[model samples]
Target: MAQEVFWRRKTLREMNREEWESLCDGCALCCLHKVEDEDTQEVFYTTVVCHLLDMNSCQCTEYERRCQLVPSCIRLEPEDVETFDWLPITCSYRLIHEGKDLPEWHPLLTGERSSVQQANASVLSVYEVRDNEISEDQLIDFILDED
Candidate 1:
């Protein structure tokens, strides 16, 4: 019999550093800017992404210092998993936290880091511009249509 995969067997809090890091699919949807509805507390994703993200690779150029450079950049941690609803439905961390399996295109599942990009599930397909290219007030105009 085959052993259970680490993600299925381990809780977010139980995984070690390397195992935790490997769970990322690298879609970069988290790098995009988001807006919240003041009344309903609903979050909306925007087409404007962080300028520090290298679009082609869908990786942050300054991974270590991202939160310092961009005040809004979120640093995902196991402790924050409960509040991960704002993350995309396909997000690996959110999926695991919610007791869901990684999507077929997830790097961990496919053993190919480019699967997310190849499947067009990456920010490269949705981003219209970098955050620095637009004014803060213009974020509403960049909200992605709820599909």
Candidate 2:
């Protein structure tokens, strides 16, 4: 019989560092800026992405120092799996945490990291501007049109 993959067999908290890191699908939607409504506390994604994100690659240019550079950056940890509802619906981490299977275009499934961008599901196709190009107050103007 064939063996099940680590992602299907292990919980997010059970995976080793390498396994956990490999779970990321590189969609880079997480790199986009978000705003929370002060009253209802609803989170809204903005089209403005982090200045450190490489538009072409959809990866952070300063991955190691991301939190230090961006004070609002939320570092994903296995312990926070239950709180991943704020993540994008297409996010791998959120999908796995919710007991959903990886999408067909996931690197682990397609064996091609570029499949995400090729599918046009990445932030590359939606982002309007980099955070550095706009003021904090302008983020609301870039809110994604969720339908």
Candidate 3:
């Protein structure tokens, strides 16, 4: 008998809540703010981080009440995977949705929680500004090329 690798065997929509939550690599790129071009719909990543994001831990400071605290915050559901294009390319949800495997540095693969950071896939360095400190007009100044 062998243990089943749940992620490879199941679709995102087929997973239970625990399985779904476990998919997060915790790189926290999703917590960064983005700017979208109205005409082209091009989404640009920015250096600004959500107010609820803890700079040290890279976890939300108010995970449960995030929706209430920030209405624009996207609550990524399994069904929303395909539509959430703003998700970083390194994100587990986006990778799985695109029929790709998780990267070597993903915590699940490396068995080390800090692997994502070690791989330089996290937002720690880029996320120098907080969302509350910047205006929409200033977002362009912080646009960053995907790492």
Candidate 4:
């Protein structure tokens, strides 16, 4: 008989720093600009990349100091994890929080950083404007991408 190793399910608060950080799948979907409908409170995602994001690596260029530079930047705190619905359905953090499985191409599953791009799950090529050059109104025009 094979021994079964039971993995403990971690809530956002229970995750250590390394586990929390590793939950990011490098898809860069959250890096895009979002437009929230004032009346309905529905959020619409745009293809405009944040100025702090590195397009090639799909990682933040100034992650540690992002809040200092962009005063409006929202930090992903443990308490707010479940409330962040604007995070994409494909997001690892959101998946893990919802008790869902990571996709096949996720780096943690495949051990390949480029799998996200190859699987068309990353915003690697399809994006525009760094946040500094774009205004809120212009985001509507960039709110594209079939999914």
Candidate 5:
């Protein structure tokens, strides 16, 4: 029998749990808080990270309890790809959803976790503060140009 190539092409839903988790580029942009202008419904990104996010790891400190602790936290699903506006432009899930190939910096592509950080895709050294510590007015200043 011929061996199946993993990355030939796979949709979000078609991926198994390990493959699904591997899709995260570890950019940590999704963990940041965002503001939306109700009138225009335009989402604006901020540097304020979720309280649960570990700045060093660029991942939630408490992943399983995120929804319980942060009621507003969004649980991304394959179906929500097109609808969720908060996802970063560089997110692997979003990229796959839009029919784009993963960037070269992605760990899956490079086979190295540090590759994302090296490419500046991971939030390493760039987060500002927990959402609870920052005021809405301060958000404007924390907006990062990293992307």
Candidate 6:
């Protein structure tokens, strides 16, 4: 019998490290800075990104040392998915955790790595501001609508 596709067959918690890593579509929206309301608890996305994120490739420049280099950087794990309200709706991990299918343009589905970019899901062309340059007072200036 043919082997089942890993994503459809295994829950995020059930997937091994390699399987889990392959599920990432590499949009890099997670690397962007966000602001949360103190009382309202609303999360806002911003164009400013982590210094470690490569604007051209939209990948972390230092994947393995991210935690050490940026103490506040969140390394998302299976258990953390459900509670991460800031995850983009197009994120493969968030979609899987919410029992939704990957979008047709997902690399795993289309077998084309550029599909996500072609579909306009990747944030490659978004503003290239860095987190280190932005102050708390200026966060609202970079706030972007989720769409």
TM-scores for all candidates: the values are 0.97, 0.96, 0.92, 0.85, 0.84, 0.89
Better of 3 and 4 by TM-score: 3
Give the clash total for candidate 2: 0
Superior by lDDT: candidate 4 or candidate 6: 6
Point out the higher-scoring one by lDDT: 2 or 3: 2
**Candidate 4 global CA lDDT score:** 0.78
**Which model, 2 or 3, shows the larger TM-score?**
2
lDDT of 1 by residue, 26-87 (tens): 99999889999999999999999999999777899999898999999999999988899999
Q: Stretches of candidate 5 above 4 Å error? A: 1-8, 144-147
lDDT of each: 0.92, 0.92, 0.85, 0.78, 0.76, 0.83
lDDT of 3 by residue, 1-147 (tens): 897688888989999999899899988898888888999998988888888888778788899999899887888898886795678887899888888888989888889988888887888867878988988789889988664
| Decreasing TM-score order of the candidates | 1, 2, 3, 6, 4, 5
lDDT at residue 28 of model 4 (Cα atoms): 85
lDDT, candidate 5, residue 24?
A: 80
**Per-residue lDDT of model 5, residues 49-135, tens digit only:** 887877776778888988999887888887766774467888888777777788888888788888888887765556767877977
What stretches of model 1 exceed 4 Å from their correct place?
none
| Candidates, ranked, lDDT | 2, 1, 3, 6, 4, 5
**Alpha-carbon runs more than 4 Å astray in model 6:** 1-3
On lDDT, the leading prediction is 2
Clashing pairs in 6: none
Writing each residue's lDDT as its tens digit, candidate 6 over 1-147 gives 999888888999999999898899988878777888899998888888888887777788899999999887889898887785678778899898888889999889888878888888877756557888977688789987666
Candidate 3 least-lDDT 10 residues:
78-87
